[model samples]
Target: MGEVTAVAQALPPWVLVVIAAAVGVKYLGQALAEGSEQWARILGPLGRRWRSRAERRTEKEAADLVALQRQVENLSVEVERLTARDKKRGEFEEKLREYLVYDANWHFRAQLAAAGAGTTLPDHMSFAQWEASRP
Candidate 1:
């Protein structure tokens, strides 16, 4: 061990420095080359295709959303129109009921008079009661 240490110590310091520098440069170059190759493998033509596919999907989703929004707006307008029509129909039905009730009352009164009945029923009596009292 002592002899080996003496021989190592006698070697020129610049020779050891040069050997260390060569090994360091070799390893550095290898690392750089491997890193560049790995990057190329991960981010080559496939990256561009993936990006384009994603963009197309986004555009399609946006178009579908706009169409759905338009459909909702049209449905809202249709609902409003139908609601107004239903309201008007209900009012017309109420008026028709009133007219029918008035006509029936006058007809009942005239029939009682023709039958020579001294007592007349109130207009509010049910049709069944009026018919039962008829001669």
Candidate 2:
């Protein structure tokens, strides 16, 4: 008893607390060995909690991925539509330029005829007529 007291006095208070905790854990472990009902009862909830959290995280990630895929699909469709509209605008501009050139030539020939020149040219077609004449 005297030696035990001396040893206890030499150790720090924290060391004694650690020893007590270890003894308590050992007793509990002995009471619940592998495959024991008490072991499952004590640790099953912790295992289930961890598994449920993982499942929820996986489900949320899958949902976010699906949403991103849908957004990409929508953007792709919009890009296709805009590209087609841009192509049509280019065609319209080209047609407008052709008509301006034809009209200029027609006016120049008419002026020459009015000034008593001998050469003649075809009459200018209207905008709609010019468009209908081309493919």
Candidate 3:
């Protein structure tokens, strides 16, 4: 490769220009014989038509990305709302259970108090004896 470069550098600039022109002409002649298909194939994305097509594809992809992002955001909000509702429901259930326990305790104590009231002893032993003797 070094030897080739040295040989190329030794050549006159005009010789290089002529060689380049010949190559260009050869390709141009081939393109002309092959018609527009050859030109379109060689130009590929460099052509204006291909560029516009690429731009349209990019725009469509961007729009799709935006739509997907919006869907993700909406789903996140929905998840947060559901999580909050679940938390609130749990708190309410806990409070209801506490109230039920308190109500049960109150009712049990009332029953005990009522039973004790019925079995109350008289202040005087004579009164107690008379009450017991009557029944």
Candidate 4:
């Protein structure tokens, strides 16, 4: 206590006031910085919550786009498959039309009956066999 008093008495009054002001300014700046940091911490979660929702929405949109693209690709493949099947069916119809024969006298039915065929009964004969079996 005696040493502190001696130091205070030795220093000029203006120097003491300058030191006191410097200490006060330093503490004030430190307090402001700490308060600003606390406010940032308090608001940080709210900012993050809004950002997270926006990010989730963006991700969902991207997923929907991918699913739509996949569906379009699947639809394109199905259309191609159906088109090919229709073309094959048309070709087969044309071939069968060429192979079929008609008679005005209707003797072709008699020929089929002569070849062990029956009326209203299924037969194990292919088109080529039935054509050949005509007597």
* lDDT (CA) per prediction: 0.74, 0.77, 0.73, 0.70
- Predicted model with the maximum TM-score: 2
Query: What is candidate 2's local distance difference test score?
Result: 0.77
TM-score of 4: 0.42
Tens-place lDDT per residue, model 3, 20-119, is 9999976665554344544645665444355455557779999999999999999999999999999999999999889968976776676678778886
**Tens digits of per-residue lDDT for model 2 on 76-100?**
9999999999999999999989998
Task: Please give the lDDT score at residue 102 for candidate 1.
Answer: 95
- Colliding pairs, model 3: none
- For all predicted structures, in order, the TM-scores are 0.52, 0.53, 0.50, 0.42
Give per-candidate clash totals. 0, 0, 0, 0
| Per-candidate RMSD, Å | 17.6, 12.7, 16.9, 19.9
Candidate order (lDDT)? 2, 1, 3, 4
Looking at model 4, which ten-residue stretch has the lowest summed lDDT?
Answer: 99-108
Tens digit of per-residue lDDT, candidate 1, span 1-135: 999789879999997899899999656554444445553345555444444555677799999999999999999999999999999999999998898799787877787895687665545646678799899
TM-score of 1: 0.52
